[model samples]
Target chain A: MSFPKLWSFHGGLRLDGHKQESTRLPLRAARLPERLVFPLLRRDGRLAAPGAKPGDRVLKGQLIAGGDERLDPPIHASTSGRVRSIEELPLPHPSGLAGPCLVIEADGEDAAVEIEGLANYREHPPEELLRRVHQAGIVGLGGAAFPTAVKLAPAGRRIDTLIVNGAECEPYITCDDSLLRHRADEVLQGAELLRHILHAERCLLAIESDMPEALTTAERALREGGFDRIAVVPVPAIYPTGGEKQLIRVLTGREVPARGLPADVGVVCHNVGTVAAAYRAVVLGETLTSRIVTVTGRGVRQPQNLEVRLGTAIADLVAQCGGYTDEAERLILGGPLMGFALPSDELPIVKSAHCVLVAGRGELAGSRPAQPCIRCGACAEVCPAQLLPQQLYWYSRSDQLERVLDHRLFDCIECGCCDVVCPSHIPLVQYFRAAKGKAIAKQREREQADRARRRFEARQARKAEEARERAEAARRKKENLEKSAVPEIRQAIERARRKRAEKTDQHATSDTPGRS
Target chain B: MLALLAVCLLFALFGLLLSYASRRFKVEGDPLVDKIDAMLPQTQCGQCGYPGCRPYAVALARGEADINQCPPGGEDGVKNLAELLGVESKPLDTARGTEKPKAVAVIDEAACIGCTLCLQTCPVDAILGASKFMHTVIAAECTGCELCLAPCPVDCIRMAPVRETAATWRWPEPGAVRP
Candidate 1:
């Protein structure tokens, strides 16, 4: 397994993967939840509006809710069911706030609505292909959940390169690694489809150099499939070498501008898992029904990667992994660094779920009292973004908003590198997050204030216009009266008197006739 | 004598070039210093043991300020600083205090009167209601520094454990494994 083209970055720590227990186990299917609560919002935090009413019978893969075309992806039914109700339910969100959800009671019959398969999807135009992808509710399954169609769509500028990210850079995450080892062919096929869609000149599949087996498997698949233009490039096993921007820089040596996207530099990056999903969608006309998820940690009775449905509960997934050990103190969704800590096992797995870890209490039991920073330079040594973490922490702590922005606070990817290597655990990431949150809140406040100002201005303009119209009407009436002579005025007065008299006479006549 | 003068002139020219080169090539300080400084938990608690968070940030930029300092900032703050500084981190400095999970500021709603002291102390304006009314801490804005907890004259303020959501749930550290 000679992975000649592998590249990596500096400053990443290698934790024990503990993958042996689960890597060899064949993928298992997760049992369905009795009731499915599907959130209308999945991508970029924008909520999708409900398309179905209460009591509507929906089949699996049926469109139940649709996103606003501008920023949302359409949502579909995960199973055949009757709409129980459209109500507020606890969504799988960090905020833990209840969002509007479509609740469905499973009918136990996995019935699916008829889907229109592309007779020759590969032959279809790129625009049409992207349209189907949007309608299919495809999102980046690699945890970002970015809308896939938006990535596939041609940018305002030309796209020359497409990088397929296969760097399963997180310590415990092996879903992508396993996918490469087991399903390399699908990944390559997906890559080819992406190339065709983007019409890109170069297609590079970037994988970590650690997994030699995956590299070989991917190489063989690429060669067997005759994808000559697609190169399987191995990146170094850095912690966040798998981050889109970092991977792009390592592979192409092109720095994705800070806060800018790979597409801005004529490159579009896709997660290997995302590409596999695309292949399934475009090649087999399959919707995103199931995905390969890595289930490994110290607290699980068993550890293995399993194929699970979109709305499967974490509890069911855990049971599939032979249930949790008594020592299991915490459960995390996704990888250890970026994964969210799950409040409960009842949370449903969505498209972005990659790993479900059950770690023991003892495994997480170290509590260090935060000490004063002794001005150690260790954080800068490990920052892949070349940022000054200590300074940002200071400004954020002081609530100095201007200095935080000046430091390009938005460019921080929150990868947890500086905190990991710090001699003193400064909780650097929290300060950055606090600053970012404060910044966002401040921006929202400013926007609201601007909107209020605009409304006030509009109201004032309307009021002035109304007053002017009233004054104009009064002047016109006065002019008409002034233009008339004395005789004309007398005649007009007599006419008005006659008209009033006639109206009174008619009213009296009608009343008298009715009485008679 | 002329050759000696020529040699002296050559030395002077070399000295000038060296000074000019040194000035031109001096490493510019990172712009992220200010931002990283702002993100520091400004309890000015001197928990980082420096004069303040600002001095610590300068030291951090000058390769000072260990990533693990302010206990008030906790693990989240450490992670943010790590991201900002572009460094890897280990466990929180055990010397400072172990990083605990998320907690929120809780006011014992039953503790008689609202003195409004906690409201004035809150940096983010997290406390709500008038001076006379019972004030509440907005859990979202509360950093859980326990700064507000100490100011309560009646010991009415308590640090309540933050509600765990699927989002805040993290896998227990692998080191928790006892061999």
Candidate 2:
């Protein structure tokens, strides 16, 4: 096994991964929920315009919405059902904001439309394959939810390496780990296909050392399949190691330039699960309808790894885990570190769902009165991106947006590492987020201001031209009057002066109302 | 001289072997203890039904603690710590404190008499302003643990919830949207 160069950054909190319970449970298909609340917006922030209204019949895997040119991946009906309602509902957002959602009541028939399959991956051109990928509505399953085709489309640059991220570094996330352990062949085949599609020279699969079984299984599959170009690289088990940039850095010893992507470094990283989804899309012509979710928490009565369909309700998934052991204090949608707390279990799962944690009262209990920053350098030591989280925190706390940007606040992934390790228990991530938000808003504001200024300038120019035209017409009229024998000059001047005075008064009042 | 040298060499060799044996035979405690300690919100707040971050880390290492004991860290912290320590993270320990969206210390400027009581009591120096001037909270620094809220004699300090923006927006968990 090749040892990837992993760095120990400034600040990182070592959290309990809590993966053993679910890791032991083999992947099981979850029973379909009575109702699946399929969200129209599956890709990042952009929602697909709903195609079907309430009471419309839709088939399983049928594209319900999304025709925006802006990378809006189609949202498919997870199950054959009647469109129960098209209404604004609270998504699994951290802020608990409501977004447009499609509610489907399952008719109990697990029906799917006949999908057209390509004979082999080699038979199709790259553009055709990319189109199929887009049609399948496959997005980055590694939580970014970026449209997959956009990622596969080659830029006007040379590509050399394809990094397969199997880090599964986030705690409580065992879906990728389980997938690797169970379906190594499919993952390798997918990697091979991705290599062909991208026309990449070599592929590297990076997995953490802690997952020995997955590492061994994947390695064995690669060797048996004679995939010499693909090498299984075992990296140090570190939190956020699975992050695309970090994983790329570990495997290739390259830093994805700040504000740049892996492709910028001549590398494209795809999650192992995402590659599997791609393969399924290319080979089976199946759209991304289901995914593996690690369902485990102390509050859960039966911890298990499940292959659940998209739009399955958290309540139903939790029910399959033998229900909550006690009144769940907090229900999280993803792994704890990056996951958001669900207001209730009624929310349906999206493609990004990897783990659902039902936290119990005991688990939910904690106290650390926010204290002053002791200037502990713990945050700098564990930062996977080698960023100064503490400094960013300092600038952010002061609302010094300029200083925050100077410290590369945009590079901060908001992984919550600094906040987790702060001796003062400061919400470091929130501060950085607020600061970044302000910066983005400020930029937008500036752009809008520029636009307004331009518009005003245009209006002023128009007014000036109109004034010139009026003056010229008045001059011409005076000249013509002077040329005429009976010139009514005094009356014309009086009328023009009165009109000018009225216009000036109106302009002055509108312009300096406060001054007046 | 040769006898003395041999004796010294033998002693050195014996010392090295002893040290190696001790290291090899020593029973290793939980490696996750330090990691769990590190992942803690580290507010030093005793709201976790424990004394401090270190004590909770020790308890977690000993399997005497639940992963979700830190309310200040909220659900995300619990999940993260649970993931790190290789244990099943529970929900926020609601008995100690309910897990709500994070809030920060906010001083009501009108009500505050500038007593500086809340300022001194603040753990993270989140409350700003010198004595006799109107105090304001550095909202970013405030952990929203409500430590400063209790110290204000005039009831001027309030826990203001942090507002969400496009930057702080996270992908909603799967199945979190209800019809």
Candidate 3:
């Protein structure tokens, strides 16, 4: 398969992939551990409310925790398990924060649930298919983990192109590559299903040029499946070329507006894993209970991809990968460039986790004392978003949020490209990330203040109106009393005159005009 | 003598144009006051010796109030106010009160006497209760002004520090870099 033209993004790195280390072995299934910990909290801070109580027996694929379709992706029991307890446990984050999680002890039976699928999904409405996807708890497996159903349904827009992103450009993450090489047919079918749902004109299946096997396998699958609408295209293996915005630019040469989604450009991009998950959800009636994770690095004895169940501990995955090697020094999630270090290996995997990179000593860059930036412009030159990193760093450090905002700080994407190229060895992306948080918080505070101000004004207006009504009522009461008193005073005077006239008549009669 | 007469005539014409412009573009309200008010945190706690944020903003716009009088606004607030009013920023006036972390008025319902005093004092009407009935604070609307605290005869209302939950936990500013 060939493309008419290929485009390139502004700035990216050509780092050593180290992907072959994990792809050396075929994908294998991870054995279910004794205990599975499912953290209810998502990376975005949304909580999936627990649906099953402790001590309750649950079947595989049964919903254990529920979530809002748009915010939280529902969690299901990975295997038939008895609920141990739902309590707080350490989450998989850089901060090592504790959050509420569901602890399930697998019974080892792997009991099945009644599986159903829409054999004729084409006959159903798009909304129904979208509902099924949401029910399946599928999210973008490309690390963003945004709700796939919500992304697929772009309101008030027309989708002309759908990009099946197999471009796993991050170093040491070969989960997508393995999935494409093995299950390319399922992914293509999923792409066809997505096309029917989106009513897109054509679909572009983008794979990184480095993965010759994945590219070849996908091409064969497309040919065998007669997927005329889907084309297998190879994108250059750039560091962040897999980023939603950057990938869109590389394929279509259309820059997604800052803070805008690909759907805004008449295109929709989905990870190859997410598409395959969607296909499974619609065709096989399977919930997202497991995912393909690449457990590799110099730290582990064996480096390979494992189709692991959700809620499996990282330690278990490492143990399955032959445990830690003598040189094992650091445990990081995702790629070395973007992934954060986990404090311990006891953290459970979630739907979003694609890579578990355990780095050996000196395998990762050690922090050096940061020197003052000399305005070298190297960071700017390598910034994929083409932002002036030095200016942003200065403004962010000085708390000049207005200037940072004016420079379009939200567009930074925290890709760490600037951090990689900075001669000063400063953590520029960290600064940007911290500043972005502050900026968002400031925005929220302003919104809350504005709301309070409006409420206060409304209350003032209401109080004033109430006071005026009370005063008007009091004035009306006084006027009514005055008007009522006039009649009583007039009646008293009339009675007094009658009594005086009667007395006068009585006196005249007594003085001998008696009959008169 | 001819030049002096022309200068006097020109000044008179300029004055007439200024008067006309002022009358033709007469503004109903002081927009400066609104700008000053927008800079305020709008807690309506009256820590600035005004009835509310807008009154203090009005005073500030009229050059009658000091920029440091607001404690709820804190140092950051003072900076914002100073920038907006084009004045030098100063520390918050400790005479009014010290700046505290963001909090909300939480009513101890069991200890509440149901006097409804807080209901009347709340600037935003965040309290919901009737005479001789339990009053609960609508936490979302409560500005944590402490105005309600004083009005509670039972002393049941207290300011509880807002805890950072998963949703509200923000990334802390990065500290000094380590080698």
Candidate 4:
């Protein structure tokens, strides 16, 4: 059957889909690693305060860190283990700075944590379903681990549609594709639940047209499961089609306003993997313990997709996959478009990690020394957000922050489509990221200065008030002394004169030596 | 003669509208002084020989105080203030004090005699205590002016520099500090 007709986003690229090496093999189960270092910092770079201390025994799937899901998702132990230590460890970041992490040594038992699950989710109201999702530590697994519960809460906003994103647009990141292919029934089941929770009239699952096989599988599962409310739509295979705004635009022909969210425009979007996780969270009594991770690249000896447990060290997975080839050069954590290079293999795979990319010496063919821009408008042409990448590049490079701010610098999503087509090979996205950081830091400094100024003013006002009260008290005391007795003032004057004479007499004896 | 009278009447109406617009949009106070005060750190240290930053700002607005007098406001601070006031930036005065890191006073409660001497010396009244009890400085409101350090009878006060926490820490500025 023909998929639903699609509309086009402004600009994108059809980058070579380097997905074959991994998808050739059916999904595999990763071997258990001996030690799991759960980064105390959540995937959003927030501190995940530990719930267990060192030497404490933690069962598999037990809550190990994170306080509330409103700000960040809670982290769970991947296997039954003993807390080894909580200290600094190499993290999955380009900066090379270490992060706080909880080290747990597995006991090989794989015992499950004691928890309860819902028997029938439909019996519960929508608010209860939201709480369950929050407790299960569910997030948008697509790069941005935005807390899902925040989006589901209408908070006085009306929503009409729920979009399930199964595009898997980034090359070599096929976890969502595999999940849809194998677990279509579960994904749709989760989508139906999401539709109900959001109170949306229609639920649409958008997949990239290139992945026809997965789309057919998902649609057949939808029909077999009698989920008439949900339909599968295949959009063009464009890079960044899975971006929340771009996906919404491609499917519904609506643009999420700048500096706003999808719910503002009567819609909400979730990754298909996120939806499937929600389904399992409500029905199967499972936390987000494991997910399908793509381990592929020319540099890897055995490139395939595997269901790896969260908090598992990357080095162990590399060893289990027959180690890296001699030609391996750089190790990247996510898709090449938006991911950063991992400083070391000791960094654990985080929840937002969808791929472990190992590029051989020549794998990055076009990525070379950046050249000067040729005043070409290609970047602006391909920008899905329709931002002026060239103008921002010039303003940012010159450190003209105010000028760039006026030009709407934050609107660029850093999708790497412009970098792909630039004739001069300028890394436009890098410039934008640096400029954004500088801008934010400057804004913070100004705010602090303003706060200091207000406090100083308040302090001065308080001091003046105190001085006034003190002077009034002294005046009232003198008046009381005069009113009590008329001769009291004369007596006080005599006492003051005697005290002054004594001070002068002492000074004369000490300095003049009786000459006076 | 009638045409000339018509022209005079039109001129009167336009003049009234213009005057009303000017009066309605008249700005109050010296904006330059407020802007200059904003550039100052507002430490109220009295290091510049002014009672507070606001009086010093007034003097600057009146062209009486030099831009170089504020030592608490370091060279960058002076530069910012000068830029706002349309004057040439100069070095900070060495007599007051050198540019210092942000600091706060921490009282050694055990050593403190509860004499309340520091309470009177603090310009900001950041210290809180009864006459015979131990005093504690509110860290948030403290200006790090060092005025309270001199009057502590037992020398129980220490000027402690602020430490950076994980939240306060930032990725070093690109190019200035590589990685």
Candidate 5:
């Protein structure tokens, strides 16, 4: 069948599709680990305050940590377990730092909390759907882990299309594809629900053209479920095509405004995994406790996708996949292009994790000393965000933050397309990331300075006002005393005059008698 | 002779226009002071030997104070000021105080004498308390100025260093590690 005409983004790479090894086997349930360590911080690095204390028994799907509705979503227990001590633990981060995590020891019963699914989700208003999505703690599972409810609301923007991203553009990440193959109906149901919530005219599910099985199954599910408004479209299997902005551009010939969101372009995009999770959340009334994780790489003995619970340690997943091979040289979370090298296997998985790639020695690109930029302009040619990576690198290296900002530094998506094309191997994305951090810090400092300046000025004005009022009060008191004293002095003078007149009259009479 | 008179009248007309333009666009205050104040970081700390950031800014604008006297602004701050004022950047004047890491004061509520000394001393009014009641510093508002340390009779306040976590972690600036 002929698909509709598709638009293209600026620059992308055609990397080796190392996806077959994982998709060869069917999806399997992961073995439960003895302990699950849930970091109190969300994937975006904000704290999710713990609601369950130590020693408290938490059932599966129970809320363990609570967070703000929009930015931070509440975390739920993946399995029935007793709360262990919440303390500092190694986290999955490029910095290899530690954060506060809620530890839970599995009770082995695997019992779940009582849940009630909504039978008539269609009747509920869009606000109710967003509220349920927020309570379910569903985030963009394609790896940003941004709160889904916030994206769905659109803040009064008119949405014409909803893009369900199934591209799974990153190599070796087949969790989304496997979800489509197995639960296409649920995914389609989610698309329909999203369409209803958005009141969009059309819903397009964009899958990679390479995954014919996923495309067919999703289309079939669309027909069987009678989701007439939803269409399954196949996009080119190019690296970084699955990015929110890139996918939106490919699906619709529109550009989301810089520093804005997809909603700004009259569209809202969500990962296919996030859409399915939303369906389950609103219909089944189940909170997002577990997700499908792909454990694959040349370093692992068995490479396949497993439905794993969140907060499961990396070591547990590796063991469940028959443990790491002898050549397992490094553990990288997500994919080779954008993922970071994890420090240890003890770090627990969070919502954003899609793949745990344990690469063998020389399996991926080895680090080399970066040479000075040759100014080949190749990085600029391949930058998906249409940025001058070379200029950004120069400014970032010299700590020229203002110039970097003037170059539209925030628009760089860090998709590694420029890094791949850079002949100097400058690690361009790292410089951009560091520069972005500095810029944000600079902005925050400016804000604080402005705030402090305002407060100081306010205080000065208040003190000046108080001094003026005090001076005015003192002057009024002096004037009132003078006013009252003037009248009293006048009465005293009149009385003195009368007394003197009386004395003079008496003297006059006595003098007259003497004179007579 | 006629040409000379015409030239004189034209000069007079141009001079009148210049004066009127200047009066129409008269600036209210010293813009140099505002520019210097904007770069001062607004800590309100008197480490510069002035009463506050604005006073120091005024002094700098008036050529009365050096640009390196602010300890909170640090070396970078000095560099920015130097660039702004077209002066050579100088090292921080350590006689005032050495630059310290950003930190906020935390009052030990138990030991707080309820003396309100810190409350009265806080320039920003970041501390919230009444007479005979324990005071707490709003960390977001506190500029990490240690002026409150001197006034506390019971020594309840201490500067707690901010911890770096995944949330607060910044990608470190790249250093030269070339082989």
Candidate 6:
């Protein structure tokens, strides 16, 4: 296998890999919870509509929410159950807000409706295959949860490199690691399918060098699966290296354009789990109803990875992992660097619920007030996106949004690297996020005003042009009338002159006869 | 003496070019009015006691109207206009209308006379109906101008705040999220 010449990224962190606590145990499927809450929207604030309501019977793997032209992913019921109520439930977001969700009271039957899959996916057109992936509701399981089907190559767009991102770079997140280790063949099948659909020249599987087990597994699987194009390329252990653009740069030395996608550089990246889900959707006739989650932290009695049913109350899953040992004060949902603190464990797992870190009391909580910036350049040193976080913070705090935008505040991925290394304990990512939101809101407002102005100006211009046309037409009509009247007036003048001459001649002749 | 005359002639020629260029690119009306209009929430709601946002902007540009006359723009809108026009920000005019939440006109179908009065009065033409058929508000296009509210003889048209859905829900501030 010709592993593409390895490349390096600009800035990254050597984080403490706490993978051993979780990866020790083999992956297990958690027992189905009696009650589950399915938020209508995903954590990233995606818009989904609930198709099932209170007192509606739904089967496992049955579509219950979403499927809109907005290109949002559809959500399926994880188990056969009746929806008890559909209302606001606690969601796993940085902002602790409750959103509308579908609450299902399990019937405990765990029955599913028969799912159909295409036997020969190769025979079908790429669009048809992509449509099935869309119908199956597959999204990037790595984190963003952006619809995966939209990432498919557009017709005539040459997609040369398909990067299968198995690099579980974030600390304390071993779900992707475990997924690759257990189901490398399945992931390869999905990547191969993606390659076929995208017609990519090469497929690169990037895994962190720390994950020797997953790398060995992928290597063996690639050997056995007979995928001529795919190869396993292990990267150095780094925080935020798993980021889409960062991973692409690490593998191919190509930088994704700002405010653009990987496809802009003839590359497409998919999470290993997402590709696995696509494989199941296109081959075995399955839906993305469950995902592997790493339930690990210093506070938990046991740390293990569980293949959790979607909408399963996280507290129940914690109990299945032998419950909390200490008062797990900081309940973070994802890895430590970027994960948000959850108010409670009762919140159910959505598709993006990859990790549920239960930190001890005051672990994730901030205690110190923000000190003044000491002109320290520590934040700039650690930014993976190579942004000046300190400058962004100053502009953001002063509400100098124009300056903030000039500094490319949006490029800061909110990875919390600056927050970790800051001597002042400054939450730099939070400031950048707030600033980015404000900037985007300002942009949207400007766009709305521009639209309205365009409409108003167009209306005014059309009216003015119409008035000008009317005046021109009236002028032309008057000119035509004057032109036609000119000859008649001339004829009248000629007749008058001739009559006067005749009168003179007759008078002269009469007078001359008298004189003679 | 000849050289001096030549210099004078050169100055005159340059002055003519400058004058011609100035006339060729002359902008119409006050450019300040366009800037002020861009700041107004372009809802065209006429809540500013003028015909539309642009007309109100024109009045402001002429120093005939106060910047605070626009309620739809709210206080921030006034501040933006004030900052642009170099004036002090003032509270919105209550006589014209107070800054209320965004609302759409809802027609009570039972009480609707189907007079099409509301449809005619709507600035954005968000209300749809025939002369004798019941009209409904296309919620997406409704600017909540409330122009249609007064024209209804039967008082069937009611202005209601737009409802919040998951799609419209915004991320709450960190301090605002109740534990």
Top candidate on DockQ is 5
- Badly placed stretches (over 4 Å) of model 2 are A1-15, A41-46, A68-70, A361-367, A465-516, B1-179
Cα lDDT, model 2, residue B40: 62
- lDDT scores in order: 0.75, 0.77, 0.89, 0.83, 0.89, 0.84
What TM-score results for chain B in every one of the models? Answer: 0.57, 0.68, 0.83, 0.84, 0.90, 0.89
Question: Which regions of candidate 5 fall more than 4 Å away from where they truly are?
Answer: A42-46, A472-516, B1-24, B174-179
Please identify which of the two predictions, 5 or 6, would achieve the higher DockQ against the true structure.
5
Task: Estimate, for each residue in B44-108, the C-alpha lDDT of model 4 and write its tens digit.
Answer: 77888888788899999999998888877789788887788787888888877889888999999
> Lowest summed-lDDT stretch of 10 residues in model 6 chain B?
B170-179
Model 4 chain A weakest lDDT span, ten residues long: A1-10
Q: What is the iRMS for every candidate structure?
A: 11.3, 16.4, 2.4, 4.5, 2.2, 4.2
**Considering summed lDDT, which 10 consecutive residues are worst modelled in model 2 chain A?**
A448-457
Better of 2 and 4 by lDDT: 4
- Every candidate's DockQ is 0.03, 0.02, 0.42, 0.23, 0.50, 0.17
**Which parts of model 6 are misplaced by more than 4 Å?**
A42-57, A68-70, A83-90, A95-98, A103-105, A365-367, A448-516, B1-30, B88-98, B101-115, B131-133, B150-179
For residue A65, model 1's alpha carbon misses the true position, in angstroms, by: 1.3
Model 4 misplaced regions, further than 4 Å: A1-4, A42-46, A365-367, A481-516, B1-28, B41-56, B67-83, B88-177
Compute the lDDT for candidate 2.
0.77
lDDT of 1 by residue, A252-345 (tens): 7788888777888899999999998888777777777677888888888888888777777788888878898888888888776676666778
The docking category that best describes candidate 4 is: incorrect
A best-first ranking of the candidates according to their lDDT comes to 3, 5, 6, 4, 2, 1
Model 3 misplacement above 4 A? A42-46, A67-69, A481-516, B1-28, B176-179
**Residues A1-516, model 5: lDDT tens digits:** 234789999988888889998999899888887899998876565677888999999999999998555778899999998998999998887778888889999998888887787769888888988988998999999998989998888887999999999999988889999999999998989988988999999999999999999999998888787877888999999888998899999989899889998998999999999999999999999999889999999999999999989999989999888899999998999998889888789889889999999998888873766888999999888888899999999999999999999999999988888888877778888899999988888888889988988888888888899999999999998666656758886677679889999999999999998998
**In candidate 3, how many Å is residue A164 off?**
0.7
lDDT of 2 by residue, B31-129 (tens): 676567656655655687775566778887887878777876678678788778677777787888866765667788988898898876654556788
Query: In candidate 1, residue A335 scores what lDDT?
Result: 70
For A72-133, candidate 2 gives per-residue lDDT tens digits of: 77778877888999877767666666677888888889788778777587988998988888
Clashing pairs in 3: none
